[model samples]
Target: MNTSVVDCQKRLCPLRYLPRQPLSDPQASSQSASCVATSACESSALSFKRQAVRRSITPEFAKKVQSRSQVPVSRRSMRLQAIRPLRSLLHSKTTVSSALRPWGARGFASALVDKQVEGERITKVAELASEQAVRVTFEDGATAKFHKLWLRDHCRCEHCMHPETQQRQLDTASIPMDTPLHRLEVTDAGDAVAIDWDAPVRGTPCTASEFDAQWLRDHAYALEGGNAEDEDTAPYPKSYRQPRLTTQQLWAGADFQLPTHDYNKCVDNIEPLMRDLYTYGLVRVSDTPNSMEATEKFSKKIGFVLRTIYGTMWTTNPTNDAEGYNDTASTNLELLHHTDGTYIRDPPGLQIFNCAAQAGEGGESRYVDSFHVVETLRKENPEAFRVLSTTPLPYFTVDNDAHLATMEPLIRVDYAGNVVQFRHNDYDRAPLTHLSFEEVGEFYKVHRKLLEVLRRPETEFCMRLQVGDMMIVDNQRVMHGRHAFQGGDRALIGCYIGRTEYESRLRVLGII
Candidate 1:
């Protein structure tokens, strides 16, 4: 070692110009001393002074250059630089990088390593090579052979290809079992290894994360079949404990003639009609005249009828105010879909509305099946469904006058957990809980998606309710919104009914 070398000190330190020591000439130090003071006493004193001076200079130099005291390298800093170059490489490239199935963007590489290394994900793509050539063995004494091309097609890694979303996007149905390959290669990938197919098929490209997902799908036993898109099982009737409706005989008559003059039959039919509303979420009465008195009478009768048992359950919409009932305005517009009484823990069971004046232009009532909305969501946005089903949300409702309002999540599936219902009025929702922040964006995302799907005119069973038409619907299951209209004095008398009354009526009728 060159002890006198100043490689460690490029700074302007006083120690830089110090005299060099030669170990071999230690005995002749005084004799060869540059200073005239070569006596034993002077030599020893000079040596002690030099040693003290060198120590003081080195510390001062280090303090001056504190930032670069150690070698300019660190695990994090190196990773940062390493990550920078990968940013440009992340964009899509047309050619197959190699035969690893696309898994994820560059960022997922580390996660893939962690998951696979811990044995959390496994590979089930056995029968590595076949075509009357190679044999492959897997755990559980299973043995199979696949054409070399089959093994090549199963390469899982980025650079080879990547999945567009959370899971792999490859559809292996097109890959025939007879495709051949000359060789295959496997390379160490930090924790989980990456497979490289020597004969890179023109279309076979994948990212590293997709490789992990594929392995997990094949080996982890966690993957499910029959539409991974369908996430929530609860919305389906079988998943919930609540008894589903057995018969759908509300509109069985093909005559198209409305039920107008049958008073006893009409009132008798209310039980089954409202019961159908509960099971299906929405129901309608065929023939009632469009008159203010008739509609109000129907509304009042339903409220009064249910009030006998429901008590406060038949209360007016929170929109009704202390000042007085103001029923002048009309909801005959392009109203959006929404669930009723979202704010209440037990939302109103039945909603009664009569068409008092149907002379208005285009004020057809539209109803969307919320269950269908659930199915559509499950098919399209499974992750969003997961977020919604798992998260509790907030919702709000307004009094008839629109002056007072209450809030809760339109979909309340948690505490009373099994029952699915909504209290949606995008315009009326106010905060009800603040448990998880992730739900803020998730709630809005799901609501927006549902709204988009629900607004489709096809989903809405639109009907022109004349002056005499009265309808009773399950407030929880059905979302009622009206189309825009002009010209006529469009008005309807609306009222709420209790769940207990509605259920009792159903039992009395034996329609359940």
Candidate 2:
């Protein structure tokens, strides 16, 4: 390690002085690295290499330093002698350096051999030639590998990604399977890295991409070599993904509490409402203005109204005629606990139902926590749970206007082995011809077991929503049904909110 050349005194940035792994930036054209050559600490031994690295400091890193410190890089200091760092955002303590990934314009920092190291970050970046990827090592001895093609495909530069729309401009199909990287280094204060895509047989030439360290960590699929025993079995890898916000608080009849909200106050502040809805899978709002307008207003708080064949804002007013909407809910029939829209991919996240008019008797709402049922099944009947979780069932709805269909497992788990979604609807479950005869028998047995769980008295939360009450249900996590009705004009105003927009609202509100 060097003893004295590094100087981070005051009113200057020492970002360019630390040791590097022999790489230079082609972006910095205006500045010269010789500004500190006249300083007493300059050594003739490494003079040529030192100046070359300093001159290549990216402007983006300097801007970040200035913005973070809230200190203007004064004009008087740019032309002066020794360069020292004004520690504010970055660690302002004794440090050392290395050539990890491309630091924004930063040189790596280190602690003495005896003292414990702090602010540990990427300390080394190397190409894993055999793996066709690049590997980054953190100071704590952790390594993550990113395939070269994946890196090239995710370039977010202006040329690769559209600025306003934030969509990819490059064609993914044209990229080589094992993309070559002519250059790749950590950049942006070691927060991100720059990549230069080597000339390929299929894709664009000399493409450059910069990826954030955190992004790399989040999307890292494997280390230098993956473990065969620890192979991922989750259908979806959590690469920058966490499907559910919190562990589902599964409930039976005795343990459940139907969360209630004030419709008026929820309009002003929906955080508490959102918290309850996501935590318990459903929430009831008291004092709702029993009108379609009010229902639409309340539904928008969750997300835009999801348009379907049943219309954007639909009203379920049971009719005597058999030929009504394609849905069973359209008629006054005793509906069993089941999930809605199982026929559609990316089903609605939340379902809103406001009692605009209450029936005289019957038509009581029934809800069962699907997540809880699946968990119980997993514990009591492991084989049945496995069969249900692994088997795909088809659901379809054909109407005069539209035909919708989808095939998905009853229980879906993430790569982390956490249950992420539940899709169960026996009423909509079309046919079972796709499965083998033995598999079909198993599916039937497990499905019956699931029905038994659903039929348990402790599982269903029965309620008769009063006029002016609004109920918001987490469609993916809860199965909803209603008791048959015969008397009075019952009207329920409701709409579906797409899961995409529902999750987006949570993110924008910082609830997730």
Score every model by TM-score.
0.42, 0.68
TM-score for predicted model 1 compared with the true structure: 0.42
Off by over 4 Å in 2: 1-120, 162-164, 171-211, 223-239, 242-247, 320-323, 398-408, 413-418, 431-436
- Number of clashing pairs per prediction, in order: 50, 12
Poorest 10 consecutive residues by lDDT, candidate 1: 1-10
Per-residue alpha-carbon lDDT of candidate 2 for residues 315-374, written as tens digits (9 for 90 to 100): 888652354676677778898888888999877888999998877879999999998898
By lDDT, the best candidate is 2
- How many pairs in model 1 have backbone atoms within 3 A of each other, for residues 3 or more apart or on separate chains, i.e. clashes? 50
lDDT of 1 by residue, 385-464 (tens): 66656665555434443444443444556553443565556545566467557757667777678767666646666677
Candidate 1 wrong stretches, greater than 4 Å: 1-264, 268-279, 289-333, 396-407, 414-419, 431-438
